[model samples]
Target: MTGNTDVVVIGGGYAGVMAANRLTQRDDVTVTLINPRPTFVERIRLQQLVGGSDDAVVDYPDVLGEAVRLVVDSVIGIDAAGRSVTLATGATVGYDYLIYAVGSGSADPGVPGAAEFAYPIASLEEAQRLRPVVDAAPTTALVTVVGAGPTGIETAAELAEKGRTVTLVCGEVLGPYLHLKGRRSVAKRLAKLGVTVLEGPDAQVTAVTRDAVQLSGGRELRSTVTIWTAGFGVPDLAARSGLSTDALGRLLTDETLTSVDDMRITAAGDSAAPSDLPFRMSCQAATRIGAHAADTVLARIAVEQPRPINLGFFGQCISLGRRAGIFQFASKDDTANRFYLGGRPGAKLKEFVCKHTLKHLADEARKPGSLTWVKDDERRESLRAKRGEAPATAERAA
Candidate 1:
């Protein structure tokens, strides 16, 4: 345990960068970040990218620590017993520890014709592909954004602001995570932007064609372009590598973020299911989980017992357009409260959050182990009780 510890982190999203940067805190530890892209994609800004406002990318030198080695490759398989990873380059990389941070992607819509017709903005490539498509379409083209989550709402608002006829089809409820007051604010803003908001069971999309979408109540809406953002699914790398995973393909881990199947392996971000209870897939959760995952690996390398995770939520910020947004406040457990900031102020706050996310990674790169977060004691206790474990000591750290 005294010589050196080599940790290979898969995926180069917010979580992967944070973990790699934080691991540099120890001089004895070497961190290698494996990713498919050389630059970091600000996933939260993909809507702006499609709207022709921003490019939604950052250089690796701006966010990743100088000490962290960057490997531009994809991990095809994980060899748990041999403690190595098989990369797409047909090379094997040995590691003392592995951090599974492969993020989530657009879920299969499952509806007929959806796979062939609908465009998704879940990743950078998808957003890039859709940008040109939107630019070439006529301004009056009928655009339909399926799903009512943050991604769907933001995409609808962005396109509507650009003078495209947009229809938001809420599968169940618009902003299902939003409180009543927050939802109302979004509804009003979307209405002002000339976006048609469709809610209720009848609004659910049953199927999609090349130029139209069919609703559940035997209704068909003419759509020149359809954008699907209903659900998210994680990569199957963990399952394919013979690691234990939840039903959704997220790596199963304990409260300490260590994989339940192998102590040498840990997980973070959207692809991690800690105690079978994964946090909501968002940048707000990803960065914190990434920091925690690094700390777990560092503790293990030092021959010290790692502490359990103690994460809390602040709120959800949804951008309506360039000029308006909604910052829905939440409790420690991430349940929306009645209070919110809407309109121009909310828009400014949302902009600040986006900038701060990038600033966070840059700061962590300069000052290793600088990021910190709040802890939800109640949620932690509930999870421990469900596992029939003893009460954990109240110890909180970055």
Candidate 2:
């Protein structure tokens, strides 16, 4: 629809990078990516970083496209009416279209003293800070990990394997996303690693302190180091910018990934909530949503009818230190099934998935739009039904 279309993609995570690289498929599009860091962070391996295993970083040159411009800056405010973004560096960048992909950070622990005492390993910077704290602690010091999600399980295992006395305090059930069989497999692995698994109502953490964690039923455990991996919260940039957002601050978008408030704005990754149904925050959904966001923008520029997003789920992979893991298979809708892979083979598969995620971004950078994912027909149908739209023929990306 124009001579040169300028698209500004905020956030340099998997979603933003994929969207930026895919936008380069068209000659008329000029993509600019803005992020707080120059290097890409491997969020999936942040636990490994905290455990002193991996660095959890990738150079932008290896993942960002040559045609895409990289701006190492943080976006403070977005002027939707003026079509510009005010950066923290006091510079403003104008764009014909904006792709919101700021991703997420650690959620606030509602419990008392949690924020002040517990270390969060959600972001790369947080992981880097926690690594030193973990190393300085005595080998026999009591380390307590709060949460039973993949991050907590992995972090607890990683630390315990390093010869630290680790305890996993699952506020709720361990691996709530996993089926009973998968959950058992994980428990077995954690037991093998000498990690104390605390579950049931008594396992709920009521408060965190300087040297101990208070749990339910008047239980208190000595914790020299406490790591919080409970929940994730997105940036408030969208809501602060006067854009429509969900309760969690994720930008609200239609099924097509276009912002419901403004046609010129779209969202992807953990920062996007489409049709009030947001995908689980993971690298698997981030890449697909990022690619779909780019396609939506490209279609609008070409004056073609943009296709709605079609995404599918594979499984959930969790690493139990460097030697063991669990791969819980999921249905297309992302619910954990009974099938799972445990032990060494599971660890290898988890490692492969982490490496493959980076390789995908690199491949998309070298060849725009080279990445593709499986489609969930049921999800598309449900979304269309919710919108009162008639069923349409399926279309797959090449």
Candidate 3:
């Protein structure tokens, strides 16, 4: 054992768990993972949890490899130069390398009263608290969902199906990422499920309150419950650590997923910005980035050359209600290239993808760094060769 040569992973989300388990595969390194919660929260399925799904969470022990050490504590900050992290409990842990996978949270809409009155379905705890309030409200209670993105759409559809008068308010078109056909299909399903979608120019929400939501044009929507899922903002942990981060609080990393300031610290999932490629804030990217981050760390520890990230997001799968959804097919880069399936068939495919994502994690946890795909040195070399010498740009020209 490489005594004290431990990899410390921050956060217990998908990316963090995958990296820890992958690092544990090497006998030369010890993996210590720090997280605030004992169990890993399936953030993608938080909407399902709000819809009363009990299978949205997995116990950490059941999903983490035995070789990985789990510490339940919140990371307060990181001392990147000193190779240590300070915890909320006033304790410090040293590490040879670090992986930052502290995921994102719901973006607070800048509208007045929104923060105080709106409930966001971003975390498990938040969703759990929302369930009871929703379940107890009158069957005809009005529930307005701000933002017509996947999260907002799913929450509105689920609540509408539960007999609530749900309205989805969006400043732009519904499913802005979806093609016209897919968007129409989603709208159809929402209407059929008794969901009212207020989109287009007048869809802007100006304020939220306990009784109703006010739109930009002074239109008042009487609502008993208000949900805000307009956007997401990753925590400023990277900025806090004095690392290079984007305006959105995402750590700026190279294609190799290593922080620009220090290669010893890496980032993945929603918290990582891979140089220039647009990394979508979704589970598909999270899973692939997690695997790649692990590969990057393992390569460094095993003294093998690191692998380049080659992620291909097949599509976007969102559950509209209990039995309907829209599957917007896309290229490896997630640019909605086409639309393959929608409605029930699309919903089934979405379910399959979610199951496969968790199963991949489960398999990795059981084997502890046994993914054979990481050893493809040829692919890594080819990617590096393609990313050949950076041409003289205006910035470099100076």
Candidate 4:
């Protein structure tokens, strides 16, 4: 099976980039990364893009291995049976192994009028489209940020910091993953920034309109711009290509990150669902899984046994603004703890985390096999045991 092997990585986000770069550990493996854009998007800084603090992109040469081929195009379909992928440009690339890391984007709002009226800043294009509208709006216009996730909070705070009026409508809770204390800290900062923090069950947005937003409590708030960050939706490429996927359309994979139905295909990043329990969408999880995906492919090439995912989280970081933020600590299982660092220190930490994401990719690109991460020991195993289920496994040695 081997003179030279071509590996096609379909996505250029954290996971895909990490996988492509790490795949360079073997001189005989050719890595080609396909993405819709040429530059590596720093998704974590997208909110900053809207705020005009950052553009949220890095040149591939800065973060990708020089040996990896960069294909600037979108993948339209995958032929697992034939070991190839078709791009939007009507070109097909055959691969000995495929890494499905097509990351997620904004979810269908489902709320009445949301799809047509609300702006989503999840991806680069979306953020670029939103920035101008926000800037063009009158300074007095009320900006409504829907959803209380990290993106929502960050966008609201960023806008508010820029002297734009912001209203954060939290359908359920503000920073649901944050400890109550951390949530309070964020609330305090938002209040200081003159942002209206609306939470609780009745805080749900029932509809978005050209000039206003309606809440579940029958209260309507006048708004000039509406931003949606409630949830994410992954690309339907897997399902469209006839691969088994989770309800959300992420490729169903085992703990080894290999496709459940095909050993030659593996998935990582936000588009990957391992054990049918996908990790929360974040750059942290994506990079870790990306490295593992490359490891899985390399292990197969070496005919060595690949290890299951042993990923763990340090915590969540949320930027309140350029000078204020929150770093919520979490347990190994990714549950939020009450302990958190807030204020200027938290801001510094958040900034560092964002920069470090790129640094990790650069480090991997510079030294293909140099990246290392903390591993979770027993939480997932204990959870699987309680569910009375066996971890998903895959065949090795492609």
Listing every candidate in turn, what is its Cα RMSD in Å to the true structure after a full C-alpha superposition?
A: 3.2, 3.4, 4.3, 3.9
Return the clash pairs for model 2, or none. Answer: none
Query: What is the lDDT of every predicted structure here?
Result: 0.94, 0.94, 0.81, 0.93
Tell me how far the alpha carbon of residue 36 in candidate 3 is from the true structure, in angstroms, after superposition.
0.8
Off by over 4 Å in 2: 381-398
* RMSD over all Cα atoms, model 3: 4.3
lDDT of 1 by residue, 37-69 (tens): 989999999999999999999999999999999
| Candidate 4 local lDDT, 342-368, one digit each (tens) | 999999999999989899999999999
The 10 consecutive residues of candidate 2 with the worst lDDT sum are: 389-398
User: How many backbone clashes can be found in candidate 3?
Assistant: 0
Q: What is candidate 2's lDDT per residue for 337-362, written digit by digit as tens?
A: 89999999999999999999999998
Q: TM-scores of all models? A: 0.97, 0.96, 0.91, 0.96
Steric clashes per prediction? 0, 0, 0, 0
The positional error of residue 123 in candidate 4, measured at the CA in angstroms, is 0.7
Q: Can you write out model 3's per-residue Cα lDDT over 329-381, one digit (the tens) per residue?
A: 87554668656698889889888887777777778888765544323223333
**CA lDDT for candidate 2:** 0.94
Residue 63 alpha-carbon offset, candidate 1, angstroms: 0.5
Judge candidate 4 at residue 327 and give its lDDT: 98
